[model samples]
Target: MKQAFDHLKAKGKPDCTTLTDHLDHVVAATVKAATAFGMNVDVARQGAILHDIGKAHPVFQHRLKDSYKHSPTDEPMRHELASLLFLPVFDKSLWPVMVEMVVAHHKSTRNDTKRKGIIDLDERFGPRAFALHSAEWGSWSPTALAILSAYGIQARPISLTEAREAYDYAFDYCKNTPDGYSEWKGLLMAGDHFASALVHRTYNQTRRLFNVPLLTYYNRQHPLYPLSYIAADSERPHTLVTACTGAGKTDYLLRRCRGRVFYTLPFQASINSMYERLKHDMGKDNPDLDIRVLHAASRLTVEKNKYEEKTIQGHMGSAVKVLTPHQLASVVFGTRGYEATLMDLRGCDVILDEIHTYTNVTRSIVLKIVEMLKLIGCRIHIGTATMSSVLTNRIRALLGPDTVHEVALTDEQLDQFDRHGVHKISSYDDAQERIAQAVADGQKVLVVANRVETAQQRFQALQIAHPNVPMLLLHSRFKRGERGRLEQQLTGKRLDATGRPIYEFNTGQGACIVVSTQVVEVSLDISFDLMITDTAPLDALIQRFGRVNRKRTPETIGKVKPVFVIAPPETEGEAKPYELAVLEASFNALPDGDVLRERNVQALIDQVFPDVDNILIDKDAIYVNGRWRIEKLVHKPKSVLFDALDIDSMVCVTEADQQAYEQAGYEERMAYEIPVRYHAIAHNGLARSEGGNKPFIVPDKAYDPVLGLQMSLALPAFYNSFF
Candidate 1:
């Protein structure tokens, strides 16, 4: 095997040596990792050895040597084509696995690009080079022939004409039906990459096998010991847990789950961090069990492997899954293609963190979906630091009253527990000034806003306000590569090529500012000296507060940090009934004497939101009645309602709009159109006004690619112009 690798390496340029060496190392490492994870040792070994054999093709060879530059018309590397040619010569039973792996090697794990005519084989492998090489291989020296024969394979020849014809057919197909090809290609690539890794293990010796017994036996103590009994004993199908931030909810939920497990959250940023945590935790108990992360940004590979594929499936079958709500939503509602794996969600134990983040309309939609999930016997646990009685009641009504439970700490108890560790600032301006001063003093600061545009504006404002201070902006709108680079620079310990720390602000070694949206909440390990944020519902505020002064500094008195909350926006005109009720309930719930303290905040949350039963019984009828009336008055299609609410409803727009939307990437903005009662009143007056079109007009530029335009404010003009 080494000699074969060496032969291929010699034919390539000096730079190619490093690439080959790196490939060898990766193959070897994969084998070791798989073996340690309890995969079949022989399969793991063989899969690694042959995984990269396709890279030896002349096309890839040239690219690795930098002798070829890619262009729109240039032929690309066809690793799958090379793999397919080599695989048939081996045992045919391994064909299925090899074929999938070969095709997936260069593709995404979801098989985003594997259609026959979508990819140009000639462009990829250099027009008929495979056929030309066949004749050339027959004339190779005996030493080379021996190496090929050792793998029980023979070299095949291909004609340039065949390659050219195949390339033309594929390219034409792609151009004519780009959508179909694009989708197919994604799936094919994913499958091929997974298969190649399995193949590489065939010739490597370092594969590791997982030992289930050892993993299961290693029990790390968790902090939520007292609640375990309650969770296990409750007959409820779901639990609404409201523990303080930093509580080991992950471990608690993992231990309480029955069969398959899924940990879900709203944001991709939080999902990424949770993925790492779950991998580490589950790796302890079931090393061989497939622990997968699923999301738009996830790295799950989909290549084929008779052994590893089954193993992967089996692991997923009874293992743990961590993903964002988007992945789950896609499985449940997506129509463009079938996600056979979604069937796996059935009977799985699901933990939904930060349930409070969903708005009213969204909450209604998600609840209905959860109700359906309940019918299928899925167990759900809702975890958050702040949950209103209304929200809890709504959750129970969807699942079952008996199935909902709460883990709440009273205001006094929480205050006593942490000793008012989190400080609340009264205004944004004061918070901003303090943050600036902190940066000037070389302290790290994190400024969080509720929306993406708000975060950008605040970041730019900070930059202008403190020209010398280094500031970094992060949000979901930026590309993944950009986000990753910024995160690394902000948090990484390593210096850049210039021999200076990657992130430098006015504070020298410690000073830097990260302006972000809600992405900063939960699971991130980075600490900030101070935080300035817009006021959200109390739970969100608490979650944001958890990000500040999280870890103990050498000079700090305790592990807690000061948190300042920007005052809530002032409301005008007739307030929404729910908002008024919430405020009144909060005011009444305040502790007898104190009006502005942590204790009062907790009390207010408890009084207004309370437990599940109070919320459902008290608010459900009103909410349902209001929703029905609004639906009728708007005369909007049910599909439009679902789309506006950002729920999993099948809604299709006209082809013209759809095409334009796709070209402009406006599908993301569709979520904003979902009507929330408060948003409607505050922005559009649609919730309260019944007569004619108001003077609302949504600016074309204001449309978000993800969350549609905030049309509430323009409702009057919109009605006047279109209705």
Candidate 2:
């Protein structure tokens, strides 16, 4: 057993890579990941170091190797099983979490699949297998004990049962929840993994340690301690910030946070972009600092020989991190093993981006998030361009005015941009016709839509209307490789080796029409001559506009181009209330037909949208000061907005593509999976099939495993039967 350990150590196994080298990497990663969640460095580092000491056992080494092959049900050797042996050698209290790290490291608690294993392996080995051969191998725990004792470290062990219970409770909670819960669970697990790694690295390195500093940057100067200002402020607990889209909200919050900072974006795509930009900025300032981007789809490009493994291992000690809101949301709402990640959020600064994008149940969920963070002493910074008074007030009530800060661009500031003569069109047909004509006239055109189906349909229509014109479509739903290829073609980049642009639309680029969904709203550096989009709420529309005529050239006047809105359905009867409120506010605020004229849009937003504070204000007011002032507005469920919009049931395509759609798992996802309020065209077919109402099944022999049957982003207009 000792020889195996020696051999593995010689091979530089991560668990045995010269204690110092391993400890340093772990410490750096823990501190960095923890900082993002606002955790205490000293505690986080200690947890990181001691989390995996039991891995020193030969039995654990053998088990890890063996378990890699068989199903988990096959009585796999667990590191936590060896933690009991450490009680006598080291402090018993510390053993609880050490055991936890071992048990929870490989698979999450939600996994229920059992392995088909030999019964003898389970009966004879049981959980005490770690100490069975300990005596023959000189007892691995004693060696760990002697080392700690020599250093005069006073530690205590926590019962294995208690640790197991905690792990079980967290696991159950995450499994029963939504996919969003997975993000929170992942964050918690990452924190635990990072913490364990950090403690080990720090102890092994023997390097000087320092508390993370909270520094502020303003116009490139480090001045006016932001943390100190935060500590001194006695104003409202929360401040409403109405900054412009590009304002440095991240920089402001990071400066104020002492322990760690969590910056969250609404979408994974946006998070990826922010991660790259933040890493680049931090790398320029602190070359030696470890920076990481954490998301299921995150990719880090570095200048190392073995970049892939190094990037993965390096995250065990990053100093800065960029992650998606889905990651953070999962930690708080997830069922299983989320406590560790929640622990990271306990002492951090949180930045919630694009808060206005949250809708209905998500709004309720986010409220719980803010409340949870506050309970754990988190300082939150909410940043958005089109924030409603409701959101601002709700956040303020939870976080308090003293902890919040507001930085908004005034009406005058908004006016400067409006003067550029950018027209905001409200008719879909007018917008579509204008863009189609532009493409036909041998000009490049960019059209943005709110949804994937919408974008695809518009692009196809443009192509059919003008057969001589070239058209391309892009969206988040496309496979990554396919999207990359299309993006390159649109940008006029390198053609393939066969002298063909990755896409047929770019035939050496005479003129092309590129239609996209919200994916192109921000972060892609490319610009277009013109853009027409479906009418999204204001902030998103403004973002879409930024994609067009981006460069402020001398020809940038009418060259500024027109932005046409695909008008929403006209509301009627009972469904009219919410839509009427929005329209009334828009008209009242901008009565003179000047939609892009001033900051009046913000006022319109406030009047139409209910303040977050007003969500349950009447109920709360009844409990305060013994005064009941009846507020006489008709109340409706938040879900009504979504239902009224009928986003879920609106199938943009026809039944002719049923077979192609079913193969794509569109029916399953729309029916039983995704909880969003939108409708899919495949739902009816799936229902009919379940009821045995369909004709004979026709097997598709030409189905390619790699490509499958591709769904056209450009659906036929015959599919648009929503009206």
Candidate 3:
């Protein structure tokens, strides 16, 4: 028994590190994080040290093998219940708090997914729950106490009756607590996540936890960028900025923030681009800044520190996080870990960079998000490009003007961003003259379509037209590995020996073309010379126009370029995604063969969306009347967001990659995924992978290295891609 730490393990698989070593990490990580977030550090430390001490039991130790999950479920030992038996180790007054921290670190004490919580076991076994846990406590109690004594958390031996009493106390606390999330549980979960993912590197990572980066990099302001010159130092608690594209909106948003920043974008394509941009721009000021990106493809995001950096992508303590609003919407729906998420965002600065909010469902959700953030004490900063008064006023009314610092560009300042000459056309065929002329004149061209099949079709046509030009096709359906490479080629920076940015799109290089979908509308960091796009909603059209002539330095301001807008689709099937009336209004509001006056964008948007106030789905949202509708510790049974948001819900791999997908490691798995909506490929008779992620195997001919996913080839050919 004195050789307590000898062969006892805390985990299974490749890294079966000892229990004491694991506890040492949990203590170090939890203490640092709790201290940073103003939690009870002493309780957190003691709780973490003893959280997994029950693993010292022979039942748990035997199940530490790779295939233990498949073992017989007769006894169904829960380590947390065994852990509570040592409550005699701590001061009597600290028992409840200590129990709160460790009892539910892995599962909620009640209503857990698998019914494996401490109280769940007690409920099932009646008087025999303690017997199941303490059956062999006598043989292992000394070993567990000695291991804790090493951490200076000494506990005297406990007879079976006292151990049963300790179990009863935890059971009572778990069964009788009122509805609310426990900060102790959040602390343990966060610390456990970092310690588990980072392992030995936990100490180094914890040393830099919850840092606030100095955004002095945004101080570089040109006279042309009006938002930049405006004073960000204000007594107001919130900020709202409405300006034209390239008018320093991002910089202003950052400047207005007072604490850690969470930057949200409207599209996934834009997330990585923004993440890279900030990690570069702000990296100097914050040499050790822990920037994070929250998204589905986060597993595939490039990292300077590889696995170690990727481990903490969405967990708390990041100086700045770049993500889409959907990632945070889970909080509103009371999804799993909502309490931890709430705790992390409390009193921090959140930048709502962009929101689609085109439909009533999304509009209500975004509005609720702003309201919830404010209620949680977050200093909210919102930046948008020329929104309609309906939406704009709704935002103002949500965060009362008394606490909001509102800023907008004057007409003269807005005029300085007048960079595109709008030309209306009938269809793709009509825009060929400009496309040919742009490439002939050594200029870059960006062709936008509303759908994947349209984009792929256009890319094919353009490939035939300009056989020798440097061209690329981008959209939502490309495999992640391919998308990363394509994005780097499109907007990646390569500084010259003199330290100036000199790359293809950013440096005015020409004779190239990129055919894409709405993914190019925002945060692409790209500046093309010409744009031939299928007309979209008025607000969306403004964003698409910004992609062309995006370079907005002092010297380049007011330099107009060419952009041809194709006529909106006439039929409902043709306009499958957007409403026809809205599309027509957007097209009618635009100026033909004249500069798109930046000052009139707000009016144009209002003309398209005459009544943004009609949208509402507040009943489905969890944040209502300035309070969280759900209780703290427990999550709602399910969320309604997956249906409301137009997001990809599944992934597929080419038939050729199916073998590699089976053999690939977790980090390499997402690289092979070509994200697709489940219904898009479900009809095809495709094979699903064996493991948990279950990636569908599409016919090899359905995917092209150059043109993304071709529903034309994938669907009628392979019909079984279901959710």
Candidate 4:
């Protein structure tokens, strides 16, 4: 039998990677990954070298050839089981973990269709041993010895009887142990996945801790604010900060971080804006902070900044990750790649900012995430401008009352920062005289709607009535590129020849109006002189109010800015996203006058969000039951299938934009795409699947540059034919 070096994986061609080379690379990677988190390194090495030993079988060699691509090979020919054959040679103490790390690497512990655990020795190993030996698949004897030698384990050969006995012992050990007993299982999975992604194994550089002390660095940047000073003095591992908007909450939260940071927000737009702001703010003074943005389109985010040529994979490592809560939900739900996420998050600091923004099912999921982060030893820091007493009590209960440190603006400080006055209005159209006067006087006016459709309608009406005013439409429905440009314009930063930020000076001196949806509620740092918005949940309304008169200055303190709150829409479905009951409660709870105090705002939030239990499903109970099912000796069935928010959306592009999508790179293509809800377009019958199960393709006529997506628009026949 010819035996030198052989690989189990050939991909689109013949096998070429030598077994020894693959083992060496993976062992090095596994050690690095495991040791980084203070996990067992020798066990990682043993699992890594033996992981692909099954590839030494002759049938697997045939399976790797092009001709056998569609042909079924003899026996089940499962290599993961083949790797387990060497269980007899290892010390019994290491048997359970090694078997679990090797056998359960690719597939879960159970068989779905048959309703049985599939890691049985008789079913996988007994019938295949003779064929493996006869076919000269390295003769089992030499294969085991070679792998053992490579791993530097001194063990004797085993008879078939000995192998069978070893399998039974190993199997029993794994069956009794829980999946999360130790992080070695996750470590093996992470190392294998990371090594496979690269053409050659290279040490992944993790983000470094801030060179200067956290408090010192932040205090120097903002000499006027003592938020960082307060944070440094706080003794608890968990922190809850109740501060006014634009009160340096972000810096305070970061100051509390002692290790790697995972900063979360509620919306994608908000997270994207925060990611850019942090990357600049943190790096301007110290360029070594490996700050990364983690999201669906995170690769494009890094590319946009020109930080490096490649995308930052989560497993590769980052000092700081700015993401939405959904990214953390992946861990609680046990979704794919969660193993890596769990490893990265272990002992890290996670900042859950704007905790009140998520609602219904998403809110429950976020609460669950907090519990899991606590369980995994993450130092949790929560910052919010609005959170009810009931919710705060629940959070303290979840992570022991004594463990949490509470900080807030003094009564005097809240009074000094109080900015907006609310006015109840029947309709924005009826208040046009006021809006017109604001625009005529060269004031920035922001109009916010709960739904995208309403935002479009408002934008059209405003544009038609005040054609001379500089107006911009901003919402989630616009193509990503269009939305990004609009956001940049709103923030007033445009790049110049030297790639430095220069103000878009043209929009500086005009009476500007920006019409948008709930996207502007958080993280977008722009101050408007006036705001008119539809009624929403109390917490959401507070976020919206914060946008007007956002930046507090010495001259602006105690001055009341006008915010007109239009009554709720007639139909419950018309409000779409937010619950009708909550909106109604919020409208009735509006203080009589426009001016609101921070303390009263907290009371309004408490009155609206009366009890934390009823905000969504009983999060504590749901999470406890879900956690019981998820955290087991062996992973329970379908454990990783959790959805934080159930918004049924699909990425869509018009027929006219299809060419641009195909020609552009991933980030560029994202600009031409739009996300539409499944229910909105399902009945129209104009949508057809874009192959590869990608988002459906629609007709060009359905989209308008200014109006955004209109599902009511009928599809043209010629465009329909292409699909």
Q: How does candidate 4 score on lDDT?
A: 0.70
Model 4 per-residue lDDT tens digits across residues 1-723: 113444445232432556565666667777877777787888888888777776666667677666775534345556665677677677778876787677666654544223223344345565444344334433655765665675687767766666656556655565566435336667777777655544343343322312222333565444335464573556789999998787788888877888778889887667778878876777656566667777655665564555342344455456777888877776665644566677878888899999898876777777788888888899999999888888888789888999998889887767777788888988877668889999889888989998888888888888889998878877777676666666667777556679776553123676888888888888777788888999989898889988898776667767888999998877778767887878889999997555778867888898898976543433322246334434332442333233236656667788877766767765677777777776776666565544433655678777888777766563445365644
- Stretch of 10 with least lDDT, candidate 3: 714-723
Q: What is the C-alpha lDDT of each candidate?
A: 0.47, 0.46, 0.80, 0.70
How big is the RMSD of model 2?
A: 11.4
lDDT of 1 by residue, 1-723 (tens): 545545454224433443245344544544444433334445443444444555555555555554556677654445544434444334556544444333433432221333221243434455454453333333332333343455444534434444344334323433333111121222222222333334344233122222122223223453333333333445655767666654545555555566567777776566666665566656655556555556443432222233443223222233566666544443233222212223345566778877666555445445644664575468887787666667666777777677675566555434432412443445566676678678778787888886665676677688788887667786654433334445445454336678676545322476777788777776565667777776555555566766665553234423344555554444622222225444344334433222234445545676566653222321221123213211100111233333544444211222123333334322132311222223333543332211122112233333333223333223444332322
Where's the lowest-lDDT run of ten residues in candidate 4?
A: 206-215
lDDT of 2 by residue, 17-75 (tens): 53334434554665655565554555555544554455566655554452345554544
Maximum-lDDT candidate: 3
lDDT of 3 by residue, 322-397 (tens): 9877777876776666666777888899998756434556666778889888887899998889577878788889
Residue 523 CA error for candidate 2 (Å)?
Answer: 5.3
> 698, model 1: CA deviation in Å?
21
Model 4 ranges off by over 4 Å = 1-25, 55-78, 111-171, 178-182, 199-201, 204-215, 221-231, 304-310, 493-497, 505-507, 614-627, 631-644, 657-672, 686-693, 705-707, 714-723
Deviation of model 3 at 544, angstroms: 1.2
The global Cα lDDT (0 to 1) of model 2 is: 0.46
Candidate 2 local lDDT, residue 28: 65
Which runs of model 1 end up more than 4 angstroms from their true locations? 1-219, 222-238, 284-289, 299-318, 330-342, 401-413, 416-427, 464-468, 489-509, 552-560, 569-602, 606-644, 647-723
Of 3 and 4, the candidate ahead on TM-score is: 3
Listed in order, each prediction's TM-score against the native is 0.50, 0.61, 0.93, 0.87
lDDT of 1: 0.47
Candidate number achieving the greatest TM-score relative to the actual structure: 3
